[model samples]
Target: MIQRFKASLAITLAIILSFTAVFAGPKDTYASTVAVEAKSAILVDAETGKVLFEKEADLTLPPASMTKMMTEYLVLEAIDEGKISWDTTTQISQYAFDISANPEYSGVGLKLNKDYTVRELYEAMAVNSDNATTIALAELLAGTEGEFVKMMNEKAKEMGLPDYEFVNSSGLNNSHLDGNHPEGTEPDATNLLSARSAALLAYHLINDYPESLEFSGQTTAEIDGQKVTNWNWMIPNMPGSLSQFGYEGVDGLKTGYTDLAGNCFTGTAERSGQRFIAVVMKADSRPSRFRQTAKLFDYGFQQFQRKELFEEGYQIDGESELPVTKGKEDVVELETNDSLSTLVKKGDEENYTIKYNISKDKLDANGKLVAPVEKGQKVGTAELVYSGEDQYDNILSKKTNTVDLVTTSSVEKANWFMLMIGGIGEFFSDIFSGAVDMVKSWF
Candidate 1:
């Protein structure tokens, strides 16, 4: 009998293990398949800013030349706002000329007394990551790099970048500037950004100024009869060197490196009608950043697809109707104001659930909405809740997975006479119930 009992226990254990394996399969599938070898990394959908995967993405570190993306943004913004134009011209300062002449740095020679158009300087700054050209543009726009650094900081705050600091427009270690660091920052400070923050900046950059891609995507460009190649080796159809690292569908973005920051890249690629943005910080080498990014892109494109989880006007099962106080109707029907969609691992839609959050202010002390509610009035919100083992939120700090909950039809207030009659009936009914309870206690 004891031997038979052991056999039964073994069979039961096998059954339990099989159930666990079946349920846990999807969550473990894609995440374990891809790994990024970087100090910090993030992958997000370009259109929705939905984060797919992240590893220590909030850890802040020097971004090196990636900081130029912000400078590029402000330059384009200035042109768009009529403060500057593509044809607007500025001359190089002695300071800019000194930086440009350094062979150790990435630069194109700038003639100090020669005027350069915004288009020329911008191309150099964006394509070659030219430090002097960046400083020249900043000085032109803000009167000094010091004032431009202030604008950079203010703009970073406005865009809700969570972890960032700007010490110079050129993204050089301030120490490299030879005692000319921006006034508001530390003398030795370097521009810093988290991997997530870098990705967010790239998201805003391409979405706002898509034309920036025309410059960033170029494998080669010329300024002053000298051709400069983009440092991003992963750019499609790269010229002459490192073409093996070229990734298809890749276009404009940015790359950076420093003794302090290591190799970093914010890359964007579109394939199969979907676009993804990825960032890697403190990578081991130039090629490693691109390799790590390719792994993320492969996982994103292969394993995930955008799915509409709930349709517009979708109503919850038991929560479809909310009670209404002093209304012609006893309850009001509630439905989602907009459709909800999100990127999910393929075949994992069942892992998502809806949570309805009714606004307390919209209801009275009795937990019921008061009468005179109008159709389509927002009463609360329905938030998407992921029940999967691997869960992630959008890069945005604000609500991204939530939609407004609204009433399906108007609820008119009951007439005074009807309210009075109902109150009288309730008063008598309560008295009768109290008498019955009192009698039951005596029995």
Candidate 2:
């Protein structure tokens, strides 16, 4: 009997192992198949700004040249604000010349005595990944790289990237040098960023400088009659470089590397209809950075889809007609202030539905409003229902998108008061008519 009990236990163990194997297969596949070795990595949807995948994404590390993304962000902001124009010319300052001449730094090899337009510098900085051009642009914008670094840090904080810290606009080491002096002492400048922060910076640039892609997305350039090609390998090799990933809907961002950072990349890709940002830091090597990013893009485009929740000016629902007080029109229409859209799983389109509810007590006896309804007013709430099993059904079901119901302009408070007075007048008129008819019948 003891031997039989042992055999039964063995069979039960085998069954449990089989079940675990079935469930663990997909998890193991993801772990084993991803070859890139990075301390941190993240893939996010550009449209919805949703994180699709993450691995130690928040751990801060040396960002190398990826710090240039913030530099680029400020440059574009300047352009947008008209502080600088594309044709604006910037001279090569002594500092800019020094960075370019320094063999230890990445530079565009700009002639010390020459001047380049803001457009040229932007292209070189973005496309060739020129550290020197980036520094020069910063100095030109803020008068000094130190001040610019301060601006960069401030911008990071404003954007809520708390883990990011900028010591130099060029992202060079500075600790080896005297704290007050940036010159000499190997400049010891290093840029700091995390996978999550890098992605966020890219997101902000793409959002703020939609025009940045016109430069970063270029695979090649001819500045000052010399040809330069973009260092972002994925732009050339990706299947839809210009047609699909071009920064028009996309924007020019930056990539980074160091022996310690190990080939980091923060990239943005946008088709007019869709946009996505992918960040991989400390990737095992140059090739792996692109590979990991491609994986991110594939997962983003394949697994998720965007659904329109509601369109602006869309009529949500109408119960009984709302009363209008004292206006040319006696009713108001409710609508959403803005169109609503959400990223959903690819196959879940038909399963989603929207339900709207409005407060009935807010209306007058005539079914009109009491004259306080505004256009795109939040008069109703909408719930999105899905049919299939939900991974986050309980959490998601509790949240609903609100729809705006617009009120007619004629439905004003004054008009409503006048309407009430008119109603009273009509009531008195009916009473007087009945009394006169009674008196005539008696005669």
Candidate 3:
């Protein structure tokens, strides 16, 4: 009878565990399908910079006018720094006039010598995809297109945008113009860029210039009282158009096309307060570009979602307090260089844990820190760990999230020479006093 009861209890426990396992939500799966024409693509969370999906994303390919994205980025940077303002007016130069005349190659049709506000010009450049307006804005910002190109390249380097090169403010293909130039003609090569770099540029621009959406996302605008329409037809006509996709939060981005480069696009979409950037390059046709982009965006929104791992200004375990050798303060604090946050799935928090490992050392007596301390100092590391029976089932599963936690402030090192001299003087004084006391006692 006892054996039978024990067997029955075991059977019940096994059944309950099996039921719990079966009822748990489905594990994450990377469900993606790329059309044959797509040569390279990438999708990323604009907030966390997490790459959700990618195919040949780092492969270098001609970006066509998508090069204009960088031009747009620099222009916004100029505005933010107060170098120019929306109402500021600029004259149309001869170069700008030339570019506007070539309709096949130019996106703008501005009349030469006409003055337009910085605001109007930005709309013409971004909304209409105006090449002439892009050149004009670059010249106005840097005195010449060449100087502006230099600034663009410099900014690219600073941003770690490797594999990107800008020979002109507008990424017009320059191979046709090369060696055919008259004396003093600036070399024109269509701006060449990769899918990854283009996405990076889009990511940085939207992040840096949130206000730029008012222009790029605009389907129609009146500049100098003239109506202009945006070139990005996907915003208005695509099946999962920004409005239809419920990506009303979507804004500011650009598109590109050239016979050699095929159709290329870089766009951002936002929903429920989370923004994502998607890039598709070298599609077979204009329509296909939209289709491919839609698919990529769908895959991102459907397959993954962003979750906050930690709140900003939330303190994780810091380095153990270290004794200050001779300073007024007894201890120093350590923290992360920035706040800790990550993109996570809907119900994975229960399996995640944050772990901290800090160094054990005390500051010296002379208020000197040991050698090897660096600015934005990193003295320890923190990691996030996920554990469950089937944690590895998901493609985006993360076993741990690690970040460097560094010293929050600078540590002043003591002058060893001064300390040595002071110590020596004290020792000699003590010896002299002891000898004098001994002589006095003998007397």
Task: Rank the models by TM-score, top first.
Answer: 1, 2, 3
Positional deviation of 108 in candidate 1, in angstroms? 1.5
lDDT of 1: 0.86
Reference-based TM-score, model 1? 0.87
- For model 1, how big is the CA root-mean-square deviation? 10.8
TM for candidate 3 is: 0.67
Cα lDDT computed for each candidate against the true fold = 0.86, 0.67, 0.66
Best by TM-score: 1
What stretches of model 2 exceed 4 Å from their correct place?
1-37, 175-189, 223-225, 237-252, 309-339, 349-377, 380-443
Better of 1 and 3 by TM-score: 1
What lDDT tens digits, residue by residue, belong to model 2 across residues 72-107?
Answer: 889989988999998998788776776776656666
RMSD of each: 10.8, 12.7, 16.0
* TM-scores for the candidates: 0.87, 0.68, 0.67
What is candidate 1's lDDT per residue for 299-401, written digit by digit as tens? Answer: 8998899889999999999888999888899999999999888888987899998889999988889899889889998999999988876757677776458
Top candidate (lDDT):
1
lDDT of 3 by residue, 95-134 (tens): 6777777768644567876788888888888887877788
Candidate 3 lDDT (Cα, 0 to 1):
0.66
RMSD of 2: 12.7
Residue 311, model 3: Cα distance from true site in angstroms:
8.3
